[model samples]
Target: MNARAEAFTRCGSAITTNALTKTFHGHTVLQPTHLEIASGEILVLLGPSGCGKTTLLRLIAGLEQPDGPNMIRFDGEDVSALPIEKRNVGMVFQSYALFPNMTVAENVGYGLKVKGIRRKQRESETKRLLALVGLEDYADRRITTVSGGQRQRTALARALAIKPRVLLLDEPLAALDAVLRERLRVEIGLLLREFGITAVYVTHDQAEAMAIGDRIAVMQRGRIEQIGAPKAIYHRPANDFVADFVGTMNRLEGRVSDGILAVDAEHTQARLRVGGGDRSAVVCFRPEVARLTAGPGAIRARVIATTFFGATQRLVAEVAPGRQLQLDLASSLHFAPGQIVAFDADPQAIIEFEKDA
Candidate 1:
């Protein structure tokens, strides 16, 4: 590896934020928060609009000042007062942000050139980075001449050329089509890990978060609702919001009796076996937990619709008069609307939350 390329693979920065916050006028957009990002780890901030994910990312980048002082540190060094450039943080936005007038190599090496690196060294480094991003053959191609995925790679190459201590990406794949975005996200995840840079990604897409993040922080309102690994967050959500946001959860709201929840207690239909003792409770489980069964005692539902998902099929079934549940079955069988079906849920798959949550 070239000296320049080798430098990027060195240990990335470890980040810490203490009581970090941001407020505008009289409203606080980001409440007091604390975060720890391990060296070379990728942490994703996942949430919907106005969830403060972007606000938190910007604060870490030094693009926006934190509401409090001594709140951010890089490898234990206070860097809250540093500006974006001085902080040595690389940023990739949704837009490619490549220089349309310049060739791909020129755009990737622009940062090194601005740092006063000599032409010979800059060209060598640019060549390496272009090849690193698999665009070696398109060094002289203009940004407008390449594919969207290539342009995205160019933007990333440009960011990494400076060997920044950290990388911040905000919805970098938001501009691409669904199919292309899906394909590129895997490529991007591999690229980021190859560089071993501490990265903070902000995105509202759950699938994107699951694919890219080593740990995902699900933000809500002005604070982080939960942070954990992708499977941990999905299978064991911290609360109702996290459960509902991370994926499709089938929730049954009714009274539990004798470790069972029956939507229609008298008919014994639509049961989600649970352990609430005996009280009004909401039983939550993933769509994959329920499976088709044949028995008079099994939970019964009337299929409202079915959506085929290639390897699996999702059924929207009406459990009660106004209650519906989504079940995913690994079956090629077909069921028409209004067809009565019996199913059973794994009791271990049940996720319970406090009523207030």
Candidate 2:
């Protein structure tokens, strides 16, 4: 890590929350929740809209006070009752939130300016932060004069200027276009790891959360459903909701008996070695895990459509009366609609859940 990254690591603080609960007009948006973020870790809170991710973030930032008896701590210091201004935390919002009248440097240095720092020291720190975000040359440019990505960089620089103990981001990249979003996702991930600051990021996009977070907390109905690394969350989901939320999961209805899962589909008798005592179950796997094969004992389906991507071809096929399956194949493979094809999933990759799952 570089000098700037080292500086951030020196100031980073571990955060702990105990029985954190939030209520709005008698409706509890966040239940009694306990979370611990290690120093220099980036934890992403991922869920759908109104899932309490933002509420948890606000509670941590002291923007919204939690119910009594709940505690928020920074490096063992209890800050549950501290207001936003006193918490020494940095926040970045979906809206860039830069002052319209301020130039990039002025905006980045606004925190120091508010704290009554000397002009020389504030200018030096502002210059260093601008360099850290690769916006050194844009210091004199007005906020409206820069691109969306540049404006976001300015916001980040401003946040870091205050030497915050923890960083809170609420869909900071949600406003960018797809191309820019993808590009900045990588850049932001590198920046977070380099800075080594404990961060809590809230987002509804699963891909973004997986790409940027060290670990993800999947939330639902104002509670955390699961918390794990990206690979663990995708491959070993704790329940049905998490399995379906993280990615495209293809499911098949079946009955398990004699160490075999027999799928219910016409023209296709699919059976896999799933050891479950005679009971109804659902076998789920990702689209990429299923492949088109000509071997026997594979599930048969009639191709409905094929969409061509640069590296892979995605085929939508009808497996049963109303059931459809999606499979990703090599782009070189050619198949017309209505053509029958047999596909099989890797036995080791299949996940068996209860019928209700």
Candidate 3:
């Protein structure tokens, strides 16, 4: 086996968190959380800033202490008291933490050097890691001379040098530009799959979470609101918060009557099939599910803006006096400002939540 594959064989471990809680000073930042991650699974902790995703990651990495002991485990071994350096966990951060004075190879081998590994073995491992990351030719280049993406790859390689049992990444792509971030997201996902190591990735970007995570844990306030695969989280949200947070959700305010819900817009009315006993309801659907049609019972709207996105075109139309609805259509379809259009959402695509929900 190659050095990288050999290293990975000794690495991947399942992780479990039991009642993991974190409190700062006098305030509790993370509520008691229990999670189990299978070996070689990529679980993403997704939430906004200050929502405790980072706190949970730090706790797993041993950078932050939990409220009590027996709270964290790796492959059934309790490691609550272990420190960050002793946890044997790899970490990659948003800031490329590369030493400016070191070359790419030097940076990749720093962890092994600190462990007092033999110079020859360290060089061999570093060479293997560089090749795995597709930076074999740039090993001797100075850290300052490499591009942002290269620096990220170096950081990843360094983290893997120790053959860590678990990997913790905290917003690792937030600092990169949009294009670079997209490109590196795919690369990182592939690398994680190839290594088959348990990883806990933290990110506030929903798209990034969907792209890389095998399963996602969506956090809110101090607790996880939902945990599921990308498709489940996107299509079958646990609550309104989850539905609104994962993607663009279009809402129609209406009242249910006679087995049908009628949405009264400024100029037209939209009907939806919903179950409720003549009560107020808010129907929600994604932008991609809303379609423009000329049939009756469609909501009348005036196109206000259109944006071309190569594969698809997005249209923002005023459905009410001050409210707008957004929909994505085929790029070949033409839409112009001030043009009146009628649109309807499929019954199967509409999700009905209580007006106050």
Candidate 1 per-residue lDDT, tens place, 86-132, comes to 99988898897888899999999999999999999999999998888
- Candidates 1 and 2 compared: the better one by lDDT is 2
lDDT of 3 by residue, 45-152 (tens): 999898999999999999999999999999999999999999999999989788999999999999999999999999998999999999999999999999999999
lDDT of 2 by residue, 1-357 (tens): 877678888788999999889899999999989899999999999999999999999999999989875488899899998999999999898997989999999999999999999999999999999999999999999999999999989998898899999999999999999999999999999998899999999999999999999999999989999999999999988888999999988888878888677787775687655565788888888888887677765788888999998899889888776798889888898999988888888877888776663
Q: Over 4 Å off in model 3, which ranges? A: 1-6, 275-278
Q: How close is candidate 3 to the true structure, as a TM-score?
A: 0.94
How far is 171's C-alpha from truth in model 1 (Å)?
Answer: 0.3
Error of 2 at 82 (Å): 0.5
Ranking by TM-score: 2, 1, 3
Off by over 4 Å in 2: none
lDDT of each: 0.89, 0.89, 0.89
Pick by TM-score: 1 or 3, better one: 1
User: Superposing all C-alpha atoms, what RMSD in Å does each candidate have to the true structure?
Assistant: 2.0, 1.4, 1.9
Q: What TM-score, computed on C-alpha atoms, does each candidate reach?
A: 0.95, 0.96, 0.94
Q: Specify the poorest-scoring 10-residue window by lDDT in model 2.
A: 267-276
Tell me the TM-score of model 1: 0.95
